[model samples]
Target: MGRIGVVTFPGSLDDRDAARAVRLAGGEPVRLWHGDDDLAGVDAVVLPGGFSYGDYLRAGAISRFAPLMGSVIDGARAGLPVLGICNGFQILCEAHLLAGAMVKNTDLTFLCRDQRLRVENTNTAWTCAFSPGAEITVPLKNQDGQFIADEATLDELEAEGRVVFRYLGNPNGSRHDIAGITNARGNVVGLMPHPEHAVEDGFGPGTDGLGLFTSALSGLLETA
Candidate 1:
């Protein structure tokens, strides 16, 4: 089975959930600490949601400088599959692994709810299990979830088919209703929704988000 690393920072609240999701998808979940520079040779990595460092300096500003993040940035550039959920997405942007910046919600409040999303591009490693244009539901929670970028960047993302997931309801006012996006190589993905929280039925929303993990595992197996 593939081994997926879940990085836990001081204030990470969803690392366990992400690990559980990986296990549910038939992969081994390896716990990694933020202070540790090693990734233990995991095939993939997940930066789960939560208030890292108490959300102290901006949302992801502090955690982006964590010791392990350097390795993550290098690995992601080399095509190691990486998924960033919620605050993880923020860190990815701050780390320059992804484009755009996350700001406060238009409503200026921390929002939490089951969000509807459409799989816009399934070619990414983290979304290949989903079909293009497929609609799914996942739990979303965060204060700084609004995605912002320049017009050219938005146009480029659209033209390049890099917009992996789009919000069906435009909850947090992301540009072009984007909910998730992947790097040009399709190995790194970041999104503001909590797929880890929706991996099991009877707990949160439906199991629609499980495809994120399963798809990554399939990608790993294909290359293996």
Candidate 2:
């Protein structure tokens, strides 16, 4: 089975959930600590959602400098598959792994719901199992979820087909209704939705999020 690393930062709330998702997807989950510099030689890594460092300064602002993040950034640059959710998404932006930044919801409040999203690109390592333009439901809960980027960057992402997921109803005022994005190499992805929470049936929105974890495992097998 593919071994996936799940990094746990101080105040992280979803690392276990992410690990469970990996296990449910038929992969082994490796636990990684924020202060550790090693990645445990896992095939991929996940930065789960939470109020890392208490969301001080800014969401993910503090966690971005954690020792583990240094390795994550480097590994991601070298083609490692990385999935960041919610606060983890903010961390990816803070670390410059992906473009765009997240701000508070347009309504200036924490919102929680089963969100509908359309998969825009399936070329990424974490999304290869999804069909093009597929719509899926996942749990989304966050205080700062609106995604913002300059027009040029937005256009570039669109032109390159890097926008991974788009919200159906534009829940948080994100530009272009963007719910997720991937790096230029399509190995690293960051999204505001909590896909881990939806990976198990009889728990969340549905099992719609399992494809992401399974996709990564499939990609590893193909390249192995």
TM-score of each: 0.99, 0.99
Best by lDDT: 2
TM-score of 2: 0.99
lDDT of 1 at 168: 92
Full-model lDDT, candidate 2:
0.96
Q: Could you tally the backbone clashes for each prediction?
A: 0, 0
Whole-model Cα lDDT of every candidate shown, in order? 0.94, 0.96
Model 1, span 150-208: residue lDDT tens: 99999999999999999998988889998889889999999999999889889999899
